[model samples]
Target: MSRLLFILALFLNTVYSCEVCEPCECNVIRFRRRFLCTADCSDRDLTSIPGTIPSEVHVIDLSYNDLHSEDLARLKLFTGYLTDLNLSYNNITYLPAQSLSTATQLNVLNLDGNILEKVDSTSFGHLKQLHKLIGIHAKTFEENSFENLEGLNYMSIVFGSQEVSENIFSHLKLKTLHTNFKTAKRIPEKLLNFGIDTLVDIYLDVPNVESLHENTFSGLTILKSVTIQTEMMQTLPSNLFHSGVNDDRKMPVNLVTVMIDGVKSLPRNLFDKQQSLKHLALNNIEDLILPKSESQVDTLDLSGSTLYRVSADWFTGFKNLRFLNMSRTKLVEVNNDTLMPLLSLTVLDLSYNNITNLPDHSIQSSQNTIVAFNVSHNQIRNISSLNI
Candidate 1:
């Protein structure tokens, strides 16, 4: 009887293995008490979508293959069930009008490494539920290319060394935009105005950008985070964060994080309007200018800067600051009252400087709250047991 039971079990296992998604791996997932499958068909050198992949597969990864636009017709089999699809690093150039007409439930799509040059209204018109889009390296986008993506909250795209079309992001309500473009001297004010009501975070990775104007971020009412990285920037406008009175929104501005690297000079009142900013990073500034305005910033980073001395007034408004990183800022000394205003500072990194001594009362005010103090790679040669 035991031998018969073993034979039956073996036969059942063989039958189940034969019905599995082949040339790809499927992992059964129990979501909401339903047994769903996620298929990974990456790096299979597949020219076409495998017919063996079950229609109930919720997530499909067909990256690193030779798939083309014609192969996407197989997505019709999954229809309204597929949630996530990754076809990155493929040779797909053009998306047919009806290619994704049935993918109404697709939430995330990644098409990173394809050389698609044009994106029109029909390419992604049916993806109403798409929340995140990764890697759209398109050159020419029609006016209404993204009008149907009402639910798209995050997008990562390359603008391909051309001027950004203002109408490309017309009706979409994006919350975060991570974009890259070369050859443009500055970001077009009109392009960002499209999502001004909903855009919260904007990361500009333009390497060749030369300058930014005061009205660069004019009307973004609910904007919170802004990180700009450009090597060619010389100076930042003092009112770069100032939202003019022309914007009629009543809600309080909520700008929180600002990181601008590789600039020459920062105006003294550069952050006078960003009172709600918490994390500020101005690394690699040639001539660092400390803002005189009292801010609510908690985490400050001046790494790779060239500040020679720190004054007591610099920390007057930094009472709530906890983490301070001045690493690589060419400082020669810290005055006795330099850090007296930082009542809540807990972590201080003053590494990679030319400081020779720590005065007895240099950090005396922060002795109680200070936890980790790093001064390595400095020219320190004095004995300050109280600060050790």
Candidate 2:
């Protein structure tokens, strides 16, 4: 009886020795195990990942599957040195908090194109060495979703027809961020809430914003350049560049250039106290009204605006002005006083207008300071009448 029992036990062990590989194409292309196992379960009809994945596996590609929150919860057994994880193009709606928090050494996490709505604050706290995060398509984010990730460098949030709150990205230390919103009505104040006081680049491409409140960008002191595109903005508030005026009673002075397109007109005293402003570009404006102030501006661009005529003394306060662009307007003639206050002016662009002739004293006031003049596509027939 003892010999018969031993033979039955040996047969049972041999039957289950080699695990049956799932009938998928990814399992056919086998490779040597570096640590324990490396599986390619992508493009298979996998409803859920097998719970027995070896901990020694380093690379796992589980993309193009029907994974959900429940399936992701089974990843708590992963104890290997997983550095890269691809879960893109899945049917995941919410992230499994327990599984993700246990994967401490995960560096790259790709969760794009999911139906995620909110990200828990402590979801990424365990990944101390995480470098990049690619899951921004959610409609909104929890306040603390990026609470303890101090080592994170890059993040991208590509939402699908959703509106993100202004304070969504506050207190993060990321160097680069790309956000696309469908109907974002307001620019959240949290965008300027980085505690570092400086950012490399920020691109805001919201198309539904209509108005920008005063002190909209008051926190970013070390910002070098800013580009904003929206369909509803028509004017700029007076204290738009002044940062944190209510809290510490200080202003942002490091701003260098401001480019605004698709506005109808500019309010009076638009740049009242912006002392450090250097370059300004205003395009696609049909009519412009200058504010009354003695502010100093270095460069100005009014290209592609339908400006008919600028009132005399319009540029009287800009004594340190250098470059001016007035290309593509409807001006037929410029008065002598309109070109009198530009003492330090150098470059002037008057192309694509209806001017038949240059004023007699237009170039007389700009003798040596003016170097380049673009007057193409105009009605000026003679070039000798003007003293450029």
Candidate 3:
């Protein structure tokens, strides 16, 4: 059959697209020549990069190894070719200048979960092509630690420095930044200023900032996504995302995701100026109150929460919302006006809940646009209210 022959040809093309390295169980993604070679050396007791790898290998995963300062010299041979390197989750302590002199072509580096207590200023100078770096340290990052990495556009630090100077990111072309200040109480003002006009995605895990300042992200004109997770954030201030004098003020960070593990109540005016918000997810929070917003967010997911009520005002401004996911919650009722404003809702997932009844006209607004209205795993014994 021609159809069977076509499938076979497609399978063979995929199988021969990459080769596996012998003795190391490494994968090689081939181009004109073999390019990306990811050798999963995790849990391997070997302390250094595999010396037997082909020189054309472009990426290497040396994570979870016992690599130390003495083994840093072994990476020099792959300097001209290797574009991405991972040295995270290792027992490495120090990153001296000599350790990086040979990584001439590295573009991305990860040093997360390491004890970098003595990295100096010149330690990153050799990585001229490096534009992204991920390191989580307690005290190694100095005020001007990133002055030499002018090409860096992205960075993720598990425990970033509070003492970082204001202008450390001024000379760089940074576009994305992720930091988890788990122990810190507040995000330093200098941190937001660092991403003035270039940052697109900013992720923070500062649990202690109970109330976010109104001017926290006022000037980040180009940001498209902002995610914040906090267990101790008790009070969320008003106008957290608002329009002001930025060049692109119509929308600031079109999507917002939060993981409030310990938050109990949602503030009413949290998203006053966030009219253009596209997607919002309040994931995995045991106790959460859906914030009453006048802004029309496109998609909203409130999975794994305990909501005892959903008044008509709860769905007032979400008229254009397309997807509503309320799975695995303690919702027992769907009142008539609870979802009346959702004129464009396409998918409604109420699965895995204690929902026992759907009152009259419960889904009347979504009867015209809904493609998937899932009410499985509930005590729903009637569908008389669902006119669709």
Candidate 4:
């Protein structure tokens, strides 16, 4: 009898100590877990993540929670297999270094809308495997905060009112850095240090920058496109598009697009040595000027700018150009030589301008390649001289 009681007690203990499996409905599930252990819970209204989170769970969504810094620390149990974590739109202010130091397998982390003020270097020291990080709408980072994330590949900084520290991204291997009109002053000089020799695109939305410092974009050798919001700009620096000292040193040999809107004037040599620029948009500009004989731009758009006139030799060196737009500029006259050197010109937009007359030789030189012409909304009394 004594032996029988001992065996029964041992069996009971073993049964109670084993991890229990929980039931989940297939209809309401978003992610599928392999173990289905008691370790994983979603939308449980548990204000805090328990430190005993099952070590086997790989993906965790603590989103839409009121989790603060202290509550986030409770997730220390997930230091092993937690690869993907989303803590967006939470009440967290600061990320604890201890909580992140052990997360070895973490690859993708999203902390988009938290009240974070600064990211300490140690917060990302252990996340060597991290690939994608999104901190779009948070406040700015402290200096050298991103010094430890050298292995990161993809990053996004969308729609925020923060000024990123200069060289804030010097250490990472970023593919995209999307920024809106956040900073009121000039772009931080450190922004040019990000080995742009490998960058594909840089989308800038600084509508308030009136003047860009010369040599502001000196190192973007491999850059493809640059989109700038120019609604509040008055003038563009002469070397706006000259990234390097010489043409051969530029990294982005196949530069594609340059989009700008709402500027007053473009200085001469705006595109000095950029041989690869293809599509250009100068929308909403009030005053516009083309480069001298030494310039080279492929496609140009001057639509929505209040332009008044185009003098002779204004577009002298745009020999490889294809498209040109001068709509809504209030232009009354264009010299005969304005469209002479543009032998490759295809499209011209002269809409919404105060153009009541065209020069007698307006089409004298542009008879062969000119494909489409827009003269709508002009005060033209006759179309006899105009021919496309």
Q: In TM-score terms, which candidate is top?
A: 1
Give stretches of model 1 more than 4 Å off. Answer: 1-19, 31-35, 43-48, 64-71, 243-252
Better of 1 and 3 by lDDT: 1
Each candidate structure's TM-score, on Cα atoms with residue i matched to residue i, is 0.85, 0.61, 0.80, 0.62
2 or 4, greater by TM-score: 4
lDDT of 3 by residue, 88-165 (tens): 888777776766676677888988878776454676867768888987464645655677787788888755444444
Q: Between candidates 1 and 4, name the one with more favorable lDDT.
A: 1
lDDT per residue for candidate 2 within 167-228, as digits (tens), equals 55665777656555666777665455673454644555666777776655666666655555
Of the candidates shown, which would achieve the greatest lDDT relative to the real structure?
1
RMSD of 2: 11.0
The candidates, ranked best first by lDDT, are: 1, 3, 2, 4
How good is model 4 by TM-score?
0.62
Q: Write the per-residue lDDT of candidate 4 for residues 343-380, one digit (tens) a residue.
A: 78788888888887777777666678887888888898
Pairs in steric clash, model 2? 121-144, 121-145, 136-157, 166-188, 218-243, 268-291, 269-291
RMSD of 1: 5.3
Clashes of 4: 5
Q: Which stretches of candidate 2 lie over 4 Å from their true place?
A: 1-161, 174-180, 189-191, 199-203, 221-224, 243-249, 291-296, 382-384
**How do the residues 1-388 of candidate 1 rate in per-residue lDDT, one tens digit apiece?**
9999998886555345434788998777668985556888999999999998776667899999999988888888775878899999999987878877777889999999986879988899899999999998777778888988989999988776467776678888999998887566667757777667899999888788787766667678788999988889888776677644564423225789989888888887677666788999999998887666677889999999888898767777778899999999999999888898888889999999999998888878888999999989998999476663
lDDT of each: 0.82, 0.67, 0.70, 0.67
